[model samples]
Target: MEIMNNDAVRNVVNDVSDQLRRALFQAREVNAANYIHVVLDPNHPVAPFDSLHPDHLEQRVPSVKFHRSMRADFQHQPELCPLVVTLYSPGDRGYRDEELLLETVDNAVSRCASVNGSYVCGWIATTLNGEEFARHIAVSSILSHPLSGRKVLPWFEPHRLALIVDRYPSFAWSRLTNISSWWFVDMLQQLRVVSPPEVGRNNIIDARSTLLPLSGRQVSAVWDDQRRIREAKLVAMAMRKAGLSLPEFPEVTLDKVVRQAYENGLYGQQDVVFFAMNCLTLSEDWFLHPVVQAALEALAGTDELTLTDILAGHSDAVLHEIASYESAGSAPK
Candidate 1:
């Protein structure tokens, strides 16, 4: 997969819209129905469902219909519920009404952007009815964990789809695929397709019964992925707070800074974020200074001061002196 620049990230909505149009056309050619699976974020400023007519929402399988069996608490909330919007080809029953609804949905999806907190995560092309399609999504949403019993994995989240597809085992992918294909916008803001394995194409077994328990390795990997995501968000927040743009602090540089923070025994979210914020404001190698090194040692020792407190205790002149030394020494001679 190619790494997308900031401009390409901004074009993700258009890319997803184009993919949905192509998927609809392909589904029609194969006599299949298209179902859009969207997990609504209650905190998002814009509510996509609010723009749709009541009748259009009525056409969708009610969130309760599929999530009634799931144990997740969020499933009970109407705003946080996952919606499966069904779209049928022309001449199909209720096709005219669906066409109008599809236009509204398409517009909403086209406006989706991670920067704005996108709610539309993925779409499915399958022969299953709306309820059956939703059932698949519900079962796939929560996975069986060997030790925890059950865990909710938001694999459908656009930013998480690539991680799930690349890191998760084959069994997980088998359960995620629908009759036709699953379409999602990956973390890179690029559209991706996952098709059902040829051997399982004819299998009609219930997914709930076949849900595989995550292995110990899978559990560790999942946790690590979650941590990295949190760390990335923290880094982004710190950059914004420092008034630094992505170009000024590219992903590659940000990743190195995060790794260095971890290497320096800064595991706590606040400490890691503080470390990252300073690295951006100062130089990435500023910690090599004796003042910064002493602070890190104090944090590692029995000192009562937290890393944030110790760092903030330093005078602006002292911190700038450290940054100036590091920058001058690291400069190309």
Candidate 2:
């Protein structure tokens, strides 16, 4: 891709809109070319157009909303629902801004790695000389995950998930800190391949409907459910296998009970990792941890067995036992 002259690119952007011009100008100063421009329509298509060949514009292909959320959490100027994402790719360039462009693209794709409903419309810009050349590239494939263009809205919106953090402080902190885009995306993909764990079984009544309805949290939970339940079941089964016998546990359900228990300090973050690794049939390091074995035995002794059992008790002893076990293990030994 040829680098468009600064003046020429500026003129093209300015012609599009003062907003676009200003955004690009500010971003250009930092050497970034890709951008997300939120407009009235997320589905609007930018037809392919070459300034050098303005008469030969390609057809417009409809774009889809790749991610959807209301920007209500912003302290200032919160946008309402139906925010659209417009990935702006200014043709490839070798200027100092190339790194910024590449970094922006990487960040955008990685953030949308878990998106399920989005379509991509191609955009191509080829600069020739001191003039302008741009085109709206079109692709037939649905751009569901890892959009190459910069995502301009929704995913970047601030959220109100303090309740979740409050409930699952230990789990949230550790998971958030250790999250890898590749691993998280891979987890989402794996969830899609397998059947979602049956809900409303194992005496674990689905309480999602009764819980405080938060769209943002609900959406997030839906996305990571498979990871949550898979982690929960593995830990539960490990407790049983370690000869921590108790009454029969409820059937595994991909719901808030299991999700909340794990998130709400019923288990350690590494326990989830070990559970996940075990699911892959990877290794046996989890078994060697004395703390883990002790925790399992302690858990087996509890009368309330199901995930629902744990959640029903606001600050239950089982949670304390698990937390205490993890805390003891975390200390220098």
The lDDT leader among the candidates is 1
Give lDDT: candidate 2, residue 155.
22
lDDT of 1 by residue, 89-176 (tens): 3356433343433443453444332344445555666655556665666677676667667777666655455555556646556566
Q: Which ten residues in a row have the lowest lDDT in candidate 2?
A: 133-142
How much lDDT does each candidate structure score? 0.56, 0.29
lDDT of 2 by residue, 153-176 (tens): 222111111222334333332222
The reply for model 2, stretches above 4 Å from the true place, is: 1-70, 76-99, 106-266, 281-297, 300-333
Which residue pairs clash in candidate 2?
Answer: 31-97, 48-136, 49-134, 49-135, 122-137, 123-137, 202-250, 202-251
The RMSD (Cα, Å) of candidate 1 is 6.8
* Position 134, candidate 2: lDDT: 11
